[model samples]
Target: MACMPDSMRARYDVVIVGAGHNGLTAAAYAARGGRSVLVLERADHVGGAAVSARPFAGVDARLSRYSYLVSLMPRQVVEELRLPITLKRRRYSSYTPVADGGLLVDTQDDAATRASFRRLTGSEADFEAWGRFYAMTAEVARRLAPTLTEPLLPRSAVRDLVIGAVGEVAWRSLFEEPLGEVLRRTFADDVVRGVAATDGLIGTFADVDEPSLRQNRCFLYHVIGNGTGDWDVPVGGMGAVSGALHDAAVAAGASIVTSATVTSVDPGASGVEVAWTDAAGRTRGVTAGHLLAGCAPAELERLLGGDDAARPGGEAPASYPEGAQLKVNMLLTRLPRLRDDVDPVAAFSGTLHVNESLTQLQDAHAQAAAGRIPDLPPSEIYCHTLSDRTILGPSFARTEAQTITLFGLHMPTRLFRADPDGSRERALRATLASLNSVLAEPIEDVLALDAHGAPCLEVRTPVDLEGDVGLPGGHIFHRDLSWPFAESDDAAGRWGVETEHPRVLLAGAGARRGGGVSGIPGRAAAMVVLGSAAG
Candidate 1:
């Protein structure tokens, strides 16, 4: 237990559990609203998953360590917080390699994209269908994205909003049916179907036709980012995004304490008493009128002296969250040559799908579910340096050094739970092999060496994420993503960040409209607290 700071007050208007981006966002808003706020973070620094690191010793590159790319963060939050953040849109949407050539969707050149589609599929029909499918999603994004920052709409109302604009069939395809089924019915090309389906399976470990429709939920969040679903690269890497939020929170008079690990949470009638250990090995306690949980629901439950199943109606407690992906970060001396003769720059700029065709993806999912690593792992890679060179040091900024992030799907926690290190090694080998299958030269040829003479590459498995960042089961979304709309009448018109307790609210990815890098949950929680204060 940490001893309380002598100069600090014993209580505050609000106390946040973690100093991640969402926690910072909530603290900024709460403090700005004239409420005394204190943010406790276990880490020595802020920014949980949304951070950049120079993993390789003496490497000149600062790579986005976890949760690369940004889309769901709203401009309203940025403007309101006055955060110093810059996001650059990607020109190429994605490029998938086929046996002969490849399919490259260039946002800047429609003709080139169409020609690339034709070159692969031998027609423009797939491209037209791609346009139509995205057009429908675009409409849904336009209508639904704005509602994220507002109160939760009833499921019926949100359905009407979507079905009215996009037609019932489109609505059913997106919200009701399995994303894999929808992709199969919408796109003819296997590569095209794979490209669309990849979004749904991003950190979610589920087949396209997963009966629970988890894939659909994941897909909905992916495409609804501020109405465009364009994943942008943060200028200074993910660290810049969290750094801005931290600065804004501090500027708003929020007291942020790092290396303060919360030990217990005592929620009662008057207020919640939080016990934590400070950096100096002393325990401290603070009382708050309201508590915002920026940690995972499971973590909050644990702090409340409960297990996963303790909170029955709050968050579904039947199954624990399980992350399904392999994250590999690499600093490359130069981009490797592609087999299809496309410029390595163009191919790696956007998402480079490697062995991720629809059939391949489905097969990989099947193998992984059967307790075996995919023979040919389905993965995607994007070069961060192409979009933002500021992440590199001055010496490497003008050189060919680049940062590559590869996210391999279908590698669930179960595969590594028994043998974390061995399984991770096997998964990394399989993932690199998958990427090499599409490249003219092996990726190893371009590997950058750290100052210690080791390869400048780091691999994080699901287990690694849990140990490294306290992600329960390493689930990136904290848990499975929920539909944005209110599921019942009781939830209608309420802020989706509410918990079973009156004084506690969720301010992380576990809240409704909370997944991804968006701070909607943080804003919603603050609004609820402010509304209660005003009342």
Candidate 2:
């Protein structure tokens, strides 16, 4: 049975800071293992970036809007928690509107997608090879999922020996060929190749042509399970997934304190002391034997007095990846116009890549690397209204397309040699202009717009999360998935759920095998704590 809180008690066996999915997962596992646990969230509600809110009077909007699609979450975590998810699965699709008024749509149906690819490249062999490659890549991704969800340590001595032997064989299998070499050998058409490379570079700073092609396979990991090769949004909105996770944590005997901003973490000889201010400006302190930090590494560093040297030697202070992001979420009154060849539903299902080819994408990435936004920037747009008909359907008393989510990547956080406000407005205008060209009509007259850059996002959320999103130089998988940092040393190979700190653990995206909506880090962290206690 769960224990009811006693008056003014500020101590527990474990205290998790940050109510993001990972943090909650850590708390849930800790409590289930017979440890008294408490979770603190800076936001009024849980689900850090993976939250849903009604920005407009009647329309629901997502915060940190573009990070909604989920494919990277591990299946084990879902099964362990028995999360109630009403997945609204849809096929993946993408459109590239050419400058010559031509639009190309890539659909999920293998035949249709291949047909589209052949139209761009004139090679049926290329089509067949692309399918073969996707199959193989997906197989590797499936094999990797189990490794991602659990702690990277062997469970038992015998199990460790078995894994070590098996790992030797597996490592030898992949050593025969580099991932980029494998892709090149599989696909003959650049268009097909470019399509495969798109997701690989989505949230990463790495160039598509880089030799780290195995990392691309990890990007595909997010889209595999839902019977679609693309990421899917939940019914209602992204918030539903977070809501389900939050519900699971609360039901598992965990308490979430919201609107509670933690100011400092004083790690004493016996336990860690957490100081924070409540919603009413009252000061408070909580101590726990084990402390799980859900905030980003950098933010946690700040809370811990910016003691970079205090971290285990060789662990660098977390920093933002090379590229910064500007997210724009709008509530539209009507659906944007689509070309005759384009499907309206395609807008909402998969990410729509606009304004660049592979070469252009490379150029844009280079420009951002140099701290400049490209003149012809690459933009990714998603029309959620088309996917979830309920969002605006009831508001208009009919099935209507009203809300759109747009995330413009590689936008120069610094404008081209101009004043701050002027530069921001110019960048915003450029973004709107690029979007307007592909959109059916102008978006300036839309209901409302909420926009934020890295700094602004850091202010709203934890600075470390922003850093994590921009990890290992903004490559989403933190590092090349195939070349995960080895865990032989405590100074290296430390991420989600487990860290060098004796009782301190990471339950956020910064942990090894980091990032994503899947609460694997939290679950893994809890297991680690439990296992230690049991021993």
Best by lDDT: 1
Clashes of each: 5, 9
lDDT tens digits, residues 1-535, model 1? 1112335688888999988889989988998998888899998889989989989999878899988999999999999999889999999999888789999899999999999989988899999999999999999999999999899899999999999998998789988898887888888889889989999999999989988999999999999998999999999999999999988888888888889999899889889999999889888899989999999988898898987443322333547788898999999889888878888788888999988889999999999999999999999887899999999999899889899999999999889988888999999998998888888899999999999999988999988998788788888999999999999999999989888899999999899887888888888999999988631
The lDDT of each candidate is 0.89, 0.58
Off by over 4 Å in 2: 1-6, 57-66, 99-108, 153-191, 209-230, 307-323, 412-420, 439-496
Worst 10 residues of 2 by lDDT: 453-462
Models 1 onward score TM values of 0.97, 0.79
